[model samples]
Target: MSSIQDLETWEPLLRLVRAAHAEQLAAPGGRFTGQISLGSWTLPAPQPRSAPGRALQVVDMQDQFTAVERVQAALRADGASGVSYVVETGPDGRPLLHVITAGPAVEHGVRSPFVGALLLVEGAVPEPWRRLPEEFPGAAPAPSADPALLERTLRERLPDAIGATAEEIAAAEARLGVTLPDELKALYRVTRARWQDWSGDYAAQERVSTAVGCELFPLDGLYIADARSRPCPWQYAAKDAVVTAPDAAVQGLVGSPGWIAFGDNGGGDRLALDLTPGPGGHAGQVIMIDHERSIGAALRADSLTDMVVNHRHEWRSDVAWNRPPVVVQVSTHSPVGIAAAARPELEVLRIGPTGAPVSLASVAGLPRLRTLTASPGTLADPLEIAGLTDLEYLSLGAEEWRLLLSAGAVPRSLSAVAIDVPGDQHPLPVLDLANELLALWDRPLITRTVLEGDLGTDGKAGGTR
Candidate 1:
């Protein structure tokens, strides 16, 4: 048996634990192998003695960076934790694997008289076993215990492994006008997990169906459901909480004109009011206060204000585009309810018709924005983003042919671009844009352009819109 005293010593316990973990990892059924081993347990740098009586104050590296760092990163990356151990010095000269039991530290020399009968193979266990805390030293938990129950309990609150509902899938397909990838379909089979708040990984790809509660679902399923851009009718399970996703698909659905109208296709048409900063330094009121209050606040404070104040710098040919455009591709089952779109100097755009595209050009004055987009029928200029050096990821529909031809200077920062064009359009500007974007990023563009119909021609000009 090992004790807390054994753990107090730094070498023996660490060596034994590492060996145990390594053996476990190397087992055929282990999740990780060939990359784990026991290493020296480096203590924290020595500090000046405070009264030379601070219980031999020592730093536990295991606590600070090692514990969370190894486990957290692994979990985040969908991997397993690394193998490691901790050891410390004891009162006796001997070293031991600290096995703390109940409330006492057993010395390394205490071997049971029935040791032969009770001893098990030292390195054959396939699980981690920890000793009791210093309160009860020398006792180690039984090794080789099944970890399934423990892992399950720990992961219970996580998003479901299964995908979204059939209704959600059908809604998104109808809205986006495209089929989802098989990989995504597989992912959809798992349960979807709602983000605690806005802004995170899911924000780019998933949005909660406010119409539906922030139910747990799979990422792929959420994407298929257009969770990122749609406004869900689902009520949140938590009171006064907002459902969030990285993508804006589902958000778009809720905000679509039809949904807003609350008709069979368009129903959710309510206004939200809130206060904002008046032109100079004055304050304004929040209209339709009963609606989403926080969204209104965000619109007034961040989105609208940004559109007005940053328009020139963010999206103007006169300004010599310098910054990177905020390029976003929101595929959702509904339309986005843009709270603010009233600037006048903005440039660069990309628009898809999962829903309505109204007043999109209204944010032209936004100084920090470069490119822009909206539904197929609503584009100020398809190529308007060309002159904005910061513009990237442009999407437009076939109706904006004139806008594409009218583009002046191609944006330099465009490394990737997606355009919706008519079959007869010339490929010259598109090629030029691709070349320019490639030069800026020094990499090939990752693009997805949609044309009115398939342009089967294999030539560069023919393949893309």
Candidate 2:
């Protein structure tokens, strides 16, 4: 029933930062009422701000595009710090500009970075970084709340919180041949202090994870703990030469050797820092590397500080890519039970009788063991895992462990237990084990095993079918 003029399109995409909402966000910081930054001077269905709270009504409908420009200038002059859009319809209607909101201190005349984003570096930043905008226009590193707050967190923000001292941090850097970024160093300090808040075994700490980067070692354990460190999964596989520098080139590729893996994202993914900056990048930008992606992905944040503050915020649009499969992944190269001993930071362990089964004795010592991966027939010593009170994720043969669970040999904290299925789609003879594991559960668990490569032909329950 509408005219052709109203039949074009009407859509509102960007999340609106209502003047009221923006005001509320800035109140905590005692900032000024922010100025509005409209996407364009000429809008299709421009709303009139005739009401006292509305500012858009100042312009007359009869005004041409030039007059709209004047209105925009006036609004900017009024100190608007955000942008919004208008939706309209006409036979020849063209979609207007988009809306975007970025605010914290709106009352303090805080200007947003959206709209043109950044025109030029101008004189705000130093040289080298000045020309970085053109070199890396899409970089959006994280920011810090305040220096004092950061210092407190790094020092002793909480009672009983203790951070890694400068000497210890320096020593770690010497061993790794790299300097820790300020934010990264601060994060390290946080790790040491976590013990005060966390009393349970380290494996349980997985539940307390707040960001994509979990299981990250504090300054103390970075290079000296566990296997010392794992070279970037890229550039070096189980066989290729290790690459460490971000700028290191091989086969016409800029190797990401500078990435230092310090944190685990609970899942198989890893949280790392790209020490080798891109065109506009810095040495300590945060990045998430998906183990399943298999290299070529040197994903990075704008800076280490930015990532710390904006964790899972606007900066992270594609979050899933940063994480690996939820299940455990025992690399084919893990040579039996050695993975559990060598990579204590990892959640997955590949053990089997055929792959030079070293020893499951290490399981008792790993405070963070989550998932054990192997065919049930290959495990030389499932009994050795009896000491892991905080163990959670596990994969095994269907029928192999019915007695293990009934005998109370498994950890009570088990969350998920599953196995791979054969082509026949028949359940492995694990009824007793399943029932026993189910009895130990305080909550729901992943009892059904999935088919995975770690699942051996010997009726092991390692993978998801």
Candidate 3:
């Protein structure tokens, strides 16, 4: 038997693996006879492979997850304390692949190993994967006591607060035509407007954004995004004012004529107050609602004062839009380029050049990220990578879109998504990914939007939202 260390002996297995994968990708018109050979392996024809060929060469490049397992297996099998290996697929089809590490893997202690390459295929990228973090059901958490030292944190951001005067609150209410919640009124007394930014702890800072200002619709800086807009939609309101999209969806989610906007999370979700007291429910309670549609709502607090005093954290708009990314798309495969992609809040990662598909997985157990995105050509199943429970938004090419649609491997937890459907292919099915989402997840279906192309007049193209 050839030892695993003997690169020459492992040639046949690599050949079989390569040929098997390429064959799976074969199609009649799009049929490709080319094969990728890395290291000592050769397919039907053994052409020269360039430096550091790819270890994972399955149609879905992510299948090379086994490559990681093998490296760690080598590390532990040989009793080595640590192991490192590099696998790169050059521009040419033939790659120079090698696996010299040993062990099931332990940690990323002080050294860096060769991470996998994430392929980027061209096609339609899905929508729910690209939304902002604040788009979630509730940011931070349901209302609780504000984090300690919030006053200090606010002081750091806002200075020269305009004390709330009885006349000021009264006049504001008269103009707006709604009774201010005690908590909201107190917040006005404390600060008129403040930027939202939080980096302390994820759980504690969940919905601290509810306290910040919205330039689009500033109700004393604490603007409610999905709440009742101007021209108040109340049963009784000023005759001259124009009514807007009520936070309650005008009897869609929860029937409440009395509603008020408090804060906009930036994306679409908003912090609001249900002013109408139901038979059992109390008035002036804080709640969360989706702005795009009447999905549902979550009660945040008994009152705005409760949210500001207890259930809040410090968050302001650092992103021009609302959500921070769990996954990031890059344009290069160079190590230096990938290093630049790291940030404290980022979870998932990808590298995709225009024509060249990017499929990478060089590191594992990423600290705090919940989702990862990649090219469908490389990793058909993202779960193969350890610790990846969810995926960030995807920007895909056409061939990649066909692959994912056929396989249907997208995660179920994703609630907010964005996609760019191409208008090239004819006789394409209008993609109702929303319907698919509604079938999969129990919550109000995910928020889906198309950025670039639309499902046009003539027969729409593939991946049309």
TM-score of each: 0.21, 0.30, 0.28
Please report the candidate that would top TM-score against the real structure: 2
lDDT of 3 at 320: 18
How does residue 53 of candidate 2 score in lDDT?
Answer: 70
lDDT of 1 by residue, 205-272 (tens): 23322211122233323222111233321111000122212321111111211111100111221221
lDDT of 3 by residue, 48-87 (tens): 3434766433444333334334434544555543322222
C-alpha lDDT of candidate 2 relative to the true structure? 0.39
Model 1 alpha-carbon drift over 4 Å, by segment: 1-361, 365-371, 374-377, 382-391, 397-407, 421-465
Q: What is the C-alpha lDDT of each candidate?
A: 0.28, 0.39, 0.37
lDDT of 2 by residue, 1-465 (tens): 111011111111111222223333233221111123345432322344465775554354433344344435544554543333222111232212222222221111122211111111112211111111112334334343233454453344233345567787888889878786666676556555354446755543553244323565555455311111323211012111112233321111122445666766667666666554444444456555555533333444555555544453232322221122222233355333354344444434545535433456655666545556566566666666676665544556554465476566765555445443233221213222334454464322212221121101223222122
Model 3 ranges with Cα > 4 A deviation: 1-328, 332-336, 339-344, 348-351, 370-387, 392-408, 430-465
Which numbered prediction scores highest in lDDT against the true structure?
2
User: What value does the lDDT take at residue 13 in candidate 3?
Assistant: 31
RMSD in angstroms between candidate 3 and the native structure over all alpha carbons: 23.7
Clashes of each: 140, 34, 66
